[model samples]
Target: MKKYNCIWVLLCCLACVGTTSCSDKKSSADEQEKGVTTVLPDTKNEVTTQILKKRTFAHELVSNGKVNARSKADLRFETGEVIARIYVKNGDRVHKGQKLAELDKFRLEQKLSQAEDALLKA
Candidate 1:
């Protein structure tokens, strides 16, 4: 039984090696053929040719009015409580609806207990 397991493992290993070798050989042959046809553009005279003539490099420096979000928010908490987390810092870009910050959940737990107690009393 041990001999049979050894044979099976060896055969599996050989099969994997055979497949990888065959694929490597095939890809290498393809790449060799592709390399022969891959022509690199001549860059030797490009810079010299451009410098032999006068050229005007014009760039637009436009002072445009504000292009901004349709609406903006200065997010603030209505009640002052210790913040548990701040996921974003100033100058960090965020997608809409991303969790930017979180209030201390321990603070909310007290409010939850109070509400539950009031419900039980009623």
Candidate 2:
């Protein structure tokens, strides 16, 4: 009876070892079949193209007070006459050589006539 008990214990231990080893073998086989590996490929030989081009970007800004430019100046009429007609309002975008406002033509002609008379008298 003692020998039979020892044999039974040995068989139980062998059975547990066999089951664990089979599971480990199955997992290793699965990993091999799936091509799962920890090694990474080298990326040092990759080439990329970068083209240089012009791009335009726009942004909006909000302010409470009046904004002034560093080189801004007030435009005044040389003859000190009232404005006859305004082509643009305040804060309107204008370009170089663009007509913004026009002076009274009659007033300008009168000034020109006065200048001419003065020159004639001189």
Candidate 3:
């Protein structure tokens, strides 16, 4: 009875697999008979031609993002003073000990003169 049950299960599995494969083949044959077609563009007639010339081309990229420096230095004056002149703009390359901007010379001179007068009185 156990052997008979195993044989029945095996036959059922074989029938399922055979039916699935036959259904797939039938659907594929029907699709082929429908004859789906695709139209390709005519390459010869639609071809674009350009004369090659030796010229310099500049590529510019516009983007919206924050750029960070590899090494950054926070610049500040030791004393609070108005800026007299600026020698460089933003994103300009700078070297070590380069003078980026100058303090107001006239105001600095006045401070020095006042300090000298106070020292003399003391």
Leading candidate by lDDT: 3
Residue-wise C-alpha lDDT for candidate 2, range 12-90, written one tens digit per residue? 9999999977774676688787996577777667689999887876778977997875565588767777788999887
Worst 10 residues of 3 by lDDT: 20-29
Cα error of candidate 1 at position 39, Å: 49
What does the lDDT read for residue 62 in candidate 2? 78
User: Model 3's lDDT to the true fold?
Assistant: 0.90
Q: lDDT at 68 for candidate 2?
A: 77
- CA lDDT, every model vs. true structure: 0.84, 0.84, 0.90
lDDT of 1 at 88: 93
> How does model 3 score by TM-score?
0.42
Model 3, 77-108: lDDT tens digits are 99999998999998899988888999888988
Show model 3 residue runs off by greater than 4 Å.
1-67
